[model samples]
Target: MPSTSIESAAVDGRARTPRFIQRQLANLHKAITTNAKIIQDAIVADTGAKLREAQLEIHLSISVVKELYDNFSVEEALSQEYRVARGQDWCDRNDAVGTIYLRPQSHNLVYSIVSPLANAIAAGNCVVIESNKPHQALSSKIAEIILQHLDRDTIAFVENLPEPPSKGVLLIDQTGEIPKINASSVHTPGSSARVVALVDRSSDIVSAASSIVQARTAFGGNSVYAPDIVLVNEFAMKEFVQAAKIALSISIEETKGQDITASQATCKIAGIGLTEKELRGSGANVVMRGDLGTIAIVEDRGSSLLQRKIYGACLILHSVRSLDDGIDLANLQYGTVAPRNKTLLACYHFGAPEAAKYTTQFIDSYASFVNHAPIELTVGPAAPIGFHPSATHRYRPAMFSVPKADCIAGDSASRSLASIFRAEAKAWSDVYEKQITSSLAPTRQKAGKVVGFFDQGLITGFVVFWVPVIASAVVGSGYGIRAGIRMTRS
Candidate 1:
């Protein structure tokens, strides 16, 4: 039934006015507020996130909904006046290109969906949030809860949202990923999470190690944004490891996000004094053969770890020569199109402001943090870092629609960029009008008779005399005032 309604919406691809979209979103918001506890518990039950973390996600979701509901306007979406453009001179006008199909993520599912969902709603287009295997139950539950309140024709809820339709697939990239801007792929960003904590030699060892452990244990290391590896200076590898072990309060067996269903791999190589080659070599014993959910403080020995993605509640410790070297290694490992090819956020920690500034120039991600890691579930107390990159940058509401340039000013003469330019243009225009009028004062534009003054270039001659004359008079008067002041002083 939902599919049929939604398919009908697709025919026109213009189901919503801005006010209607906001009103529908407000209904969803009211439903969410009324069923807040159900949603929170659903997230916890579905994703294994702790209660507090689940609460934060729900709060963020509600915030986004309210923000979109209040901020979105139908008239504003279609057209806006450009203040400087006088009238009919210049402005920006937005046109909804087509429909947007939103896809939820595999893990941290609720937090993931809130961001893109809010944006799609704000973009004021036909929005459909369809579910996949991981999101089947939750999506069905949400569809059941929220669908009744939403406009079925304008916005649809597909309990099992299918693969994106071939029509109006907004993205085409050589990167092989179908562009999250269109539909999220089966391999979500969580699969290739690469968060490295760059600890410089000058950093306080205990503070650095404790904070690193605190971040990984945040939401029990379930977030894709959590630290997977700690790359510290080789100068402090020993002291750092001891402090980190104290801070890591849980055993490797207790790691939350590990798939008990999948086989665990670890190795003797995740030990002291293993060489770089030994760690990366094909020898089975030297490889990390089992899941090291516990902290493993190995030397900066090369491991398939950097070359691969680790989603478990795991932290691999490695040493680097300098903070700059750590940045280089992170970029090599986590930068887009790099070996791992998926990193949404990266962080750099330095002791001094200068050091932090110097190191930041090379770091890359959809978002980057200095002095602090991007570790929080949401921007509140437990994890103090306050950036929501996905909602803010990666999938901004701006992406869903395109703003076009328009002219609203009177005519070409009134379209000047500056006040002076407008005045000059108006003055010249008036003079041209005056000249034509004066020439026609004695004789009118007679039938089949060319205006003799126009043919004699009277208007052009007037323009030539008056334009520079007005300009020079203004310039000369300004200069004359300045010269008079100087002479009086003399």
Candidate 2:
């Protein structure tokens, strides 16, 4: 286990005052503002994040914290907001969600620490964050600033990886610790824990192209979100292929010599299946050319992107003659299947006459939300645009991989991942059953009336942290329990 330590401000065991809470919130705002430069410096020094990227991540984190502060101040959480929306909306806007844990990894110090932590804090849950990465000094500085600003009860920025000994309501695991999340597999029967894995697809062609050109290629072709393959539709194949070729040139030109060399080297790797022409292109990793178009590896096969919640770029070119084909293709890709409102983006000449039918068919079929544009669907939470369907619910994050890994590479990745998930599910199920029995089992166990079931946060947290480390964990862990009258209502 990593070494753990606490910086205690209180000498006695007593809790602080409400006035203190207000003061702390204020101080937190100030600390983030004051340490802006320090934080930026620390992020760049600790990790290789460019000064600009560091600044944005830090800024966003601060903004999220501020949003949380505004919503969760003693007054706001107590005073309920209007109840226009029901369960989903209620959960979305409420602050009573369980505790949240934010653990950032070493390399991308700023993102790992800030993104999850800020989002958790914004959701009105008490937060405990771990800031021990490659840049311990920077992390420590950040922790110090956070601690100085927030109230002890609402937020705890800890130096320990084990956390503050307080069972997390939920954990935002920065480290890819899949086994810990899926605790029930090999040892037990069923799994109570659930996890949400976020993967930004490089298959989203428009966004991938934009990222390559606009976003300063911070991750090179190494981003998990970088397109593994451009699945072109039949209708858009010719144009998309031409555009893609051009885009590859632009990417190579922009990336200069960095990616093209990798692309060439990748072609030479045994069974990599890269074409000489593609090797001469900008895309790195394996580049396979086919009748439809090309599938660039973007990065090495099954790189770390598969493990982390990909929030970068993906460029996929899909040409479809019919709407059904589009949906089939989407599902074929094992797409995240998010609300159409949040899933698709319209780029370049996408909304034009040629692409318009494909776009309209998708929105109509999926019933997505469309603010503007012709062919667009929302994938995640950023925003919904274009002709999105009215029924904009049922959105989940998409997961994809790079290089057309044939039977060997593909099966290798899948089998290992599947085995890990299976083990984890079994372990968690046993623990969850035990908790239920203890909670409702006539004996007066301190576990209390089974108000509900499972730590919603913990379930999701486990998934986030443990899935990749052990994919089998996802297999047997879907079991859940319902609260009974024997349980006291909260």
Candidate 3:
């Protein structure tokens, strides 16, 4: 286990403060930037991710740290003004959501964990992270790095997710296995997902196949965002499949450069929890590099591939009767057949933009890329989200914080952030002016229930008891407004 010194530090009163949170984040940033190469090498050695992929994880991790430091501020969070259209008659502020347990999905290791970790820190909450699966070792290294910079209480790591804290926890389970919603999920479940890539007759078969091939073969099918079952218009099936095979036919020597031994590639494919035979059993045609050079392509009808999250280098090409049929099938697969949003991503490559738009409406997915696949080859730690429906919240610092409303109800008040700030300055100035003058202080504004009256230097008010009125208004508003579209130009 990594040192729990930070956890030990948790008992200190200051550990929960915003300043300590900022210091922890700054130290984490320093560690990432200082030891980027060591972390990258560790990820590669542990995950079998290519050098570029591992490097991307490290690069992204550093960027997220920097982004969090620049954006999420403790002082800023406390003072956020939820300006009401009623023009300062009411307002809201943010309260720390409280200590959050960040459950990072281990599939992508650094990429998955770091994003939420940054947010949790920014929200000014101590976080306990739970890491698991193939990336457990990588998780430990991250904890080790974090420990060097952060005190134990500010951040801690556990082997498994515990009972939810009083404050909400970030359940970053990319596997779609989070029993209930936590903070977020970068990858939803694919156990029942079916990919539908529409390749019309007029579609660029070569481009479609190339992108899909790259997505499928890229990173050895670990990417949940990749297409599992491509829905090619029946008229273009043969051409698309042919193009796909050609795309995967890149030289064996080139594939060999990835440094995977033939022994691993030729494994009973059964051992990896997925095999071509099972996929073929569904009436799909198999195409791959000779002697199983890593890439595997299966051509089948849409019905043949459903609810199967295949691991390894395999792409499934399925035929659809028509674009409408494809859309309906895609819709049916994601809508009724699959639980939750089974399809994480759908890529449509077609000449008819209108018809493609119709397909996306029916296909239940987090994101759909028109004329493009969801495989991003950028140099950073990343996950496919924000564009699609996710079970988890956006990887933002705010999700870790609670918003407690500090409402000031009045008929009139400062109308803008600038005005309110100016008033606050004046209030402080008035206090100093009285102190220097050494005169009997003016009757301070006495604000209270039962119509209490008071006056300040520049302000006066009759404080009516607002308790019962507000209580009734809360219930009255429900019955007061009719449900309909109403647009107002404030």
Candidate 4:
């Protein structure tokens, strides 16, 4: 498709009424909900996801469309449109970006595409999706549903994005590559971004193990939100490892009757109980391997496993000395001169509230969860780069729009420009001289007893030295007087 077609469609999208956008979103929701079963089946067939997982993906996709539809109100839209005309200020007003070009990932195929697609439509932007993976059943099904429900002119699907992409296009790339096109883009770091989990000594071992295990094993464990490597407090490592073993066992048992795809089965490492020395040569020790996943303990600090993101159903564990140690390890980049900061996709801090706070304060991640990884994140594309993830929605409507505030009020300056222009030089000079001549004294603070460690140590030393000397002097004086009294009596 030519870039001109997309540009023209964007022009038409901007001209659409709020009512039309709402109706189209509703149409999408109905179509998705009506064909929920087919979509779920297609997801499983294409991705080899379990039936239950596929069902959840379909459910989340429908919810995305429904939420956008329900939040949109024609009356509010009309009010926003006429606010400036009525001589009022619209503080939160935003205009839709002209066009949204989506390059979606295959992870959770339904939710990944539907999320941005719904948000774009709801925000009144034309959409152009890159759906080149027709070999996948889920991709074809999604393209079919979208084309059947949405207006043909407002949306288009191409095998590839137009080269030298049109200016002012909003590109949403979930495929993880930073597009070289000339447009504003939102793209995930893809497999390069890592999600880390910190298990403090104060954390609930069982709960942390359960949550991390489930996250690592769900949907064949390819989720971007899954823990790439867990940093467990050294004191808690023993208990955490035991808990994780039990959790993994229970998870595997739950899926015993379910079909295991060849890809998922291949993720399991054959030999268990491999010695640390033997694995140290290879960088990781496999503690246990099962049909569902493998649990490995990282032995090397500079291991590639610690530096890169894990894409399979494997859980990697490493021990840290303390919360600060965990932060250091989390920030460690194998070959970089400086530690990684603000580069993690997300951090799951499983510990007491204070420990969690400390971990989050020092470790920079795009999003931080205290104890549990929200299951919703496992279903959608990683939150777009430079945008925070929503608790409810995967992609927010604001991400699709740009701030275009409608302000009618005048600036709140202390003095009017006309008044300044009319003021005499003597008046201005007097004001300036008064301001400069005024005394600027620092405020007094209340005095209190010094209670720092060094101060306390000094006080303790004084008492320790003087008490012995004073007691000895008194005792010597009494002994001398007693001796003198006895001699006089004799």
Candidate 5:
């Protein structure tokens, strides 16, 4: 990887117009869809992932290119480019950040590379993808496809980082480790962080179990979004465990007899039953294990499984006393004096909306899901650190761009501090006195229904009590009037 190549790519990226970028993305999309089968086969060959999983990765990869192409507008881009010349303020304007260095993860190699590559190109950036795994079938195939369709000057696949790394380069590192290079980077530190699923008693046990099992076993359980451990409410433990066993059994049976290469041997699960003494000594008890995955129960918080990341299809189940207990367990990091907040990669809260909201509020994670673990998350690289996770794509176009606002109009609401400073001492005193004497306006109430459980119960009681009584009184009065009329007639 020559330093000059990246430099040339960066220069070319800056010169690329929105139309040119859009055309390139369109070509890439066409190329991917045309060669979808080859890509899918390569994915399966490299990762030993199921054919369906490979198909999904290919589909998602094509979607990335399509999404970028569809969302990009040549008219809006040109307008922003010449906003200042047209004497208009371009608020919230962003320009491409030149070259993007992508280090993709290996779980879903096709999706990992395609997502950032497409986003960077759509944002008018040149890309330098680090495809060091040339021996990998998926990597080589991706390089072949990308190079054939994309502009050569604007895109280069290098096995190593460019020597004497350039400044102002945006590094998208999905390899988990924070890049040691001296450049602006959007690295997902949480890729290596623990992802925990909290299953409250209020949650649907069957749904939670199904989701947990699928997420844990999908794509050989290499997804970073897969829950490293599950914190089931103590009250729901029995039912949850039962449901999880059924789900895991079904998943294992589905993937039975699939080819397991030497690389995938680690993902295989063998059934084992540990005694009470063994469970306490080991801090984990394997309840269910099969060809596809394993399910273990970890009652001890100090268990090493709770402290570290689980890369295979092993689901660690722990009983939590309450929502607070789940939160506490989710924040478990070994060797920390006090539990750190917001250290989790992602939190999956399986409960009622109220319980999920409470869990999310107290637990700090990069991403939080209420009920389901998204299958999309099991494919692409984790969202860049400090940015909100997108439900559709891994990296947004804006992440590859730098803020470049053009201001042509003055702000009317901005007060002049100079005017206040220039005021005379007596004027300042008068202004201070006026401010001190002025009554503060009351805070406006928040909009929408603010009713709580007690309030709702009271309203229900009022309606239930008054409606029947009122109806009875009206009926009795009508009956008496009818009888009086009959007596008068007689």
Candidate 6:
């Protein structure tokens, strides 16, 4: 059996090469555009993803690449402007210090992985990648296209997520691996990198129910991202169930076309809510509605909310009595959210300003507001953009303490440390350490005997060399006395 260490192969001298890095990214951009026709044709041809979804990914990847390039270029211009405006203080963007690993969802390579990889490589990282699925003719074709442009070794694409050949975890002996993205394996980004996980909670209960109906009648409800669990606030359970029933009722009639099992084994964990119909279709037990929110999320109790990365539209609602509860939930579940992931946290009487502040604070992974402005702007919050990495969560970016280790704009350390330090310095002052302090005083005399010293109540001793005790005793305290005695005797 052969074993492969992907990062080891790509990393050289603890980092990646820049010249080749830029070239690969530039080529990737061209490849994505060049292969757009093939990508769309292949996805549609293969029936893996919806054509529009595939196309959207292509567009998004291109847009992101362009955005990253533009951002870097603008930063350069800004530096020049600053130099011109105020002599030589301006600074321009330079090559970054470490590698960025882009781990994308399986089956959707073009949008999720490739585009992000291009951006990461452009930022100057030697990249190593793994494909989510293996033996797909479409993936093979795309990989060939990508390989033509970039160095094969610089960008590795594992056929699928399997243990290293030597790890002894045989594929046949175990429960099969799911076709999903693994966030932990990507390089840590030089001890100062940020890692974000994206998830979309069950966004459409109506659609989920309808899909279940369709699947039961047409196919099966064994699809990824299907609403596996329904977490509603115990208070809102009735309202949520009513809303879901209404939504499903509308969907059922609209299609007049499907049979959804709303009862089977709706595994209702203590706090998780689900019915027999929902559980019949769920891969795991659903969390029931309870008197919990962000705070509950943080305290992983037996009957609390779930915090693992959830994709697809498995709706998990956490009921909260107050805004503070919601934010506490966000902090607890910070590990679960990512950019572009969507889910709803409801509050009945909250206003937008308070909504915005709280949502911004709750921001994790990618924070978004679906139906209404995050907090229900009608009575919720007005700020559209939800939570961002911040102090309450202890998220900050790297400070780039040294010139050589220039930090990326949104790296992990920056989000957890630098960001927190700058935003909540007063609150976190006691924990901050000063870089320099006065030296300690020596505690030994020239006589070689140990001398003692006191410093702020700390006593310390050290030994030092001196003349013999007999000689010192004879000569010490007698120089003047002996001289006087000699004079009197004369």
Query: Which candidate gets the maximum TM-score versus the true structure?
Result: 4
Estimated TM-score for each candidate: 0.64, 0.45, 0.68, 0.84, 0.82, 0.43
lDDT of 1: 0.58
Q: For model 2, where is the 10-residue window of minimal lDDT?
A: 394-403
* Residue lDDT tens for model 5, 23-116: 8888889889989888877777666678888898888888888878888898988877887898888988888888888888766888888888
**Which portions of model 2 show Cα errors greater than 4 Å?**
1-22, 70-99, 105-108, 115-126, 132-138, 151-160, 163-168, 174-218, 221-227, 234-238, 241-323, 335-490
Q: How far is candidate 6 from the true structure (C-alpha RMSD, Å)?
A: 23.3
lDDT of each residue in 210-321, candidate 6, tens digit only: 3322211111111221222233334443445445445444533553332222211111211223343443343333433221100011113233224343322234434454
lDDT of each: 0.58, 0.40, 0.59, 0.79, 0.79, 0.38
Task: Write model 4 residue lDDT over 36-115, tens digit each, in one string.
Answer: 88887777766678888989888888888988888899999998889889988897987888778888886787888888
lDDT of 2 by residue, 1-490 (tens): 1211212222121112334434554566687788889888776555444455567656655664565456445554333343332222233332223444455555345445554544444343455677674467877887777777666655676666453333323444433343355211111101111111111221344533433322213332222222333334454454444545565555445443332333333223322333445343533443334321233333322233222222222233334544455454443333334322222222222233434445445432223212221111111121112223221221111100011211212346567656655787877577557768884447655866553456777778788988765765544343222244325454
TM-score of model 4 (CA atoms): 0.84
The TM-score obtained by model 2 is: 0.45
Evaluate model 6: give its lDDT: 0.38
Candidate 5 local Cα displacement, residue 387, angstroms: 0.7
The lowest-lDDT stretch of 10 consecutive residues in candidate 4 is 265-274
**Which is the better candidate, 1 or 5, if ranked by lDDT?**
5
Count clashing residue pairs per candidate: 18, 67, 16, 0, 0, 53
lDDT: worst 10-residue window of model 6:
374-383
Shift of residue 180 alpha carbon in model 3, Å: 6.9
The sequence of per-residue lDDT tens digits that candidate 3 reaches over residues 329-417 is 66665544444434445445564677667666666655566776644422212233443332232366555555665555553433543
Q: Candidate 1's residue-wise lDDT over 22-104, tens digit each?
A: 77678878877888898877766665556666677777767778877777776755445334443553444554535666555
Cα error, residue 123 of model 4, in Å, equals 1.4
Q: 126 in model 2: Cα distance from truth in Å?
A: 4.9
